[model samples]
Target: MYCRNCGNEVSEKAIMCVACGTPPLAGNRYCPNCKAETSPDAGICIRCGVGLINTSNHSEFDWLTTLLLCLFLGTFGIHRFYTKSIGIGIVQLLTLGGCGLWTLIDFIMIVVGNFRDGNGKVVVNKQRA
Candidate 1:
């Protein structure tokens, strides 16, 4: 992969670009997939035909916190709220977590690391609360 900000080659798992001191996907000046120069407003890379996504602003939600919320306050949809799933949270809140069945399923999903946030990004597996 390439850093979108500086067109520098970077590892796929790199959090930030070493050359530019910025998140690897932060800029639209270059294509992260092919290192091709791209327009700032372009949505997809012309050379590689890959969608350009700016993931620099994405927040890494803690997996442990979500698990704890689901275990302790899932009846109130607290875990859904923490994951920014407000609509589902409201539904869970009104239904009392589908009479506790939905909460149990959510607990299992979180434990198995299949839970996702509002943006469909997986929760970070950090031990922090």
Candidate 2:
């Protein structure tokens, strides 16, 4: 493997690049698989055909806020609205949260930290992360 920042060869499991003093995959100047130079915003490494997604990062939505909203105003789909799930929020609002069954299920999902935002990102507490 190679450091994406400096193109310095690195152990596959290494955390940071010794040559550049940065996370091995944190930069976009080079490809980690083939050491080929890459455009900053390129999603794939051209030479190696490898994806460039940073696997170390997982962006999660707030769990507490979603949980509380679901507990208190789920019947009105307030939690859904807060998560930017506008279409589902409107449906829930019109249907009164599926006559409360949907609200109950959503509350349970939130309590179990299994809820997702409109963007499909998982909702989890920062401490848990």
User: lDDT winner among the candidates?
Assistant: 1
lDDT of 1: 0.84
- Candidate 1 is scored at a TM of 0.64
Mind giving the per-residue lDDT tens digits that candidate 1 earns over 38-93? 98767788998999855532336778889999999999999999999999999999
TM-score of each: 0.64, 0.57
Write candidate 2's Cα lDDT for 46-101 as tens digits.
Answer: 88899986522322457888888888899999999999888999999999999999
Q: Judged by lDDT against the true structure, how good is candidate 2? A: 0.82
Over 4 Å off in model 2, which ranges?
A: 1-60
